[model samples]
Target: MTSPDEDRRTGAVHAVAAYGLWGMLPLYFVTLAPAGSLEILGCRILFSVVVAAILIRWQHGWGRMRTALRDRRVMLTLAAAAALIFVNWLTYITAATSGHVVETSLGYFINPIVTVLLGVVVLRERLRPLQWAAIGVSALAIVVLVVAYGQVPVIALTLAFSFGLYGLLKRQVSGRVDGLSGLAIETILLIPAAGLLIAVVSSWGQLTLLDHGPVHFALLAFSGIATLVPLLFFAGAAKRLPLAHLGLFQYLAPILQLLTGVLILHEPMPATRWIGFAIVWLAVFMLVADVLIVGRRGRA
Candidate 1:
């Protein structure tokens, strides 16, 4: 067995790797934009399903898969999560392609606050003062974003709510369905819908992959591995790290996204955006602080 220190280090690596891969997702999505949002989303589901199937089979997950599907509630929950995640993927790709990566980043930065609210509302849980403060700050950020953009930050808010609901659904899933098996179920649940979409696209001569060359083909393969590897790492981390610490590391992805949009993509941002980002960041800080403090008190 691994020593405590070794296990901690390993968990940290896995968590960092998982978030880092996610941080680089915009680059992968950018290459596929030529294919259209629907096609990209469909392909992601198709590819993710295939890869997850192979991994699950390799890990002797057939029995587990059968057991999970037998439960109607679990099946329904997974289906709901699949739909939410698909929406999240489509919106994210569209945002990146439209030069709104900065706004997309805002979604993630505010997700934790959203999650806290979800707990209070859906889970009927109570929150401490710090949690309420975080929620208020996050709400302030959205207001600032709307004022700055002269319209709603629709994409960012969509991403946040969809993902928040996805997590909420996942919480009700009976057992840990996170790694290969969990991901497999989510993808497999969507395969039928994705297959229909792909078939329609193919019939219309609009299936972009059929016409792509070596480079595009290579990127598509990379996307599959890239998607799976981080999920596996996250699964590993989830088993080893405290949930509170894991929550803190989740911010890394949005931080990278914001940096990429501003520095690499050269996306424009006005004064109100700065104010919005500031509020969002402050909210996340409070959320993390609350989690850590609660965790420490429990330990004490």
Candidate 2:
């Protein structure tokens, strides 16, 4: 058996790989240019089912999938998860391809705050003082962005809330569902909607999957594997790492995304937007500090 230290090291590696892949997703999505978001989303859903099937068979998880499907509660929860993830994926794909990657990064930056708020509202969990302060700072940051942009940051908010709720729904069925099985069920649930999207996009003549050469078609086909690999890594990490460590690792994705937007994509970030992001970063700092302090006290 591996020692705890070795397990943690392995988990750290997995966590880094997962978040790193997620961070670089904007780059991948951008490369699929000429393929509209709906078309890409549809293909992602359809092909993910194919990939999930192969993985399920490889892992011998057919039994678990059947068990989950038979449980009404599990199926309902996963159905809800499927819808939320559909929204999250669509929003992210649109933003990434439309040069709004910075704003997309902002959405994820505040996701921890949204998750905390959901815990308060949905789980009836109490927050520490720092957590409350962090929320306040995040709120201020939103106000700053609204004033600066002369409108709500709809993309950021939508991505944040959709993903936050998605995470909550996943938690509801986590006990009964393995990551691969859960994803398989969720993707299966989305098949009809995915088909409809493909039909609609094709009608509009915006479906570029076939118009593009074989290279583009191959990339679209590989979307399923791209989606599944990181999730599997995340699952492995979660099983091996402490929650606190996992939570901290979540920041890597947004940070990389922000860098990709500003440094690589040359997305403009004016002073006001920088200030808003700085405020959000401050809030994130408080949350991290709170976690560390509370964890230390627990150890003590």
Candidate 3:
């Protein structure tokens, strides 16, 4: 048997691998361009169903999936989750393809704050003083960004709230739903919509899946695998790591996305935008510090 330290080391590696894949997703989505965001989203959902099926068979999770499907509350919760994730995926794909990858990164950067806010509003949870301060700073950052862009950052807000709400829904059914089973259920629920979307896009002669050559077609077909692998890695990491440790790893993706947007994609980042992001980063630091302090106190 492995020692605790060894398990932690392994979990850290899995966490890095998961977040690294997520961070590089902007690059992957960029390669799928000329394919419309809706089409890509549809195909991703379609393919993910296949991959989830294979995983269900491999892991013998059909029983759990069946149980989850039979429960009215679970199905309702997952249905909402499916819709929220659909929105999040579509928005992220659009942003990545439309030169707003940096803003997308910002959305994820503030997701923890949004999650906390949702807890306060939806769950009636109380926040510590630091959490309140972080939220206030995050709000200020958004105001700064609105001024810098001369409009609300719709893409970022959409991604943040959609994902935050998705997490909330998932949490409701967490006890009954394993990661693979939950994803499989969500994808299954989305299959009809995904099919209709593909049909509509094809009817318009805008479908690029076949026109993009073999490599691109293959990439589109394998979108399901791309979606599933990182999630599996994340599940592995979650099983071995503390929630706080996993929370820290969640920031890796957006940081890489921000770097990719600025360095590799060469998207314009003006001084005002930088100032807004700096404020968000400051809020993030405060949030992290609060988590650490609370964790230490709990341990004490």
Candidate 4:
């Protein structure tokens, strides 16, 4: 058997790799801009279905997939998760490709807080005082953004809430299905709608599928790998590591995304926006500290 320390070390590597890949997703979305967000979303769904199906086959999860398919409640939960993730994908792609990558990063920065709130309100989980303080500080950051920007940070909030809800729903059904099988089922559920939408886009002149030539077509197909591979790394990490460690590493993606936006992408960040982000960062720090403290206390 693998030693616990070795497993944790391996998990940390996988988690970092997963988040690093996710952080670079904005760069990937930039290349797909000609395809339009909806078209890219559709292609992502279709190709992800193919990729996830193959993974499920390799994992010998076909039997589990069939069982999950037969279960009404699990199907319903996955359907909800699928809808939320679709919204997340479309929004992030649109935001990133439209030069709103900074705001997109903000959404992810606030996502953990949103997830914690969902746990409290929807799942009836209790939180420590520091966690509540973190939530309050995060809310203040949102208000600051609204006042400073003269509009609510809708992109960030939408991304945060949609993904938080997606995670919550996935957690609910996590015990029932493995990651590949669940993802395969969810993508399979999306196929009909995605197919119809793609057909409609093709009927219009806007579809970039064949118009962009073979290279673009290849990129569209390769979206399957882009979508599934990081998730596979995350699944591996979750299996090998403690949840607390995994949770801490989740911040890496947003940090890299923020850097990509401000540094590499040349997105403007005014003083006010920077202040709001700083406050949000402080909130995240507090939340993380609380988690660490609580974990230590429990161990003691």
Clash pairs of candidate 2? none
Candidate 2 — worst ten consecutive residues by lDDT sum? 146-155
The clash count for each model shown is 1, 0, 0, 0
Candidate 1 C-alpha lDDT tens digits along 82-101: 89988898899888877889
Give the 10-residue window scoring lowest on summed lDDT in candidate 3. Answer: 29-38
> lDDT of all the models against the reference?
0.83, 0.95, 0.95, 0.91
Better of 3 and 4 by TM-score: 3
Q: How far out, in Å, is residue 155 in model 1? A: 0.8
Task: List candidate 2 stretches off by more than 4 Å.
Answer: none
Lowest summed-lDDT stretch of 10 residues in model 1? 174-183
Q: Worst ten-residue run, lDDT, model 4?
A: 29-38
Candidate 3 regions exceeding 4 Å error are none
**lDDT of the structure predicted as candidate 4:** 0.91
Pairs of residues clashing in candidate 4: none
Comparison by TM-score, 1 against 4, better one: 4
What TM-score number comes out for model 1?
A: 0.95
Q: Over 4 Å off in model 4, which ranges?
A: none
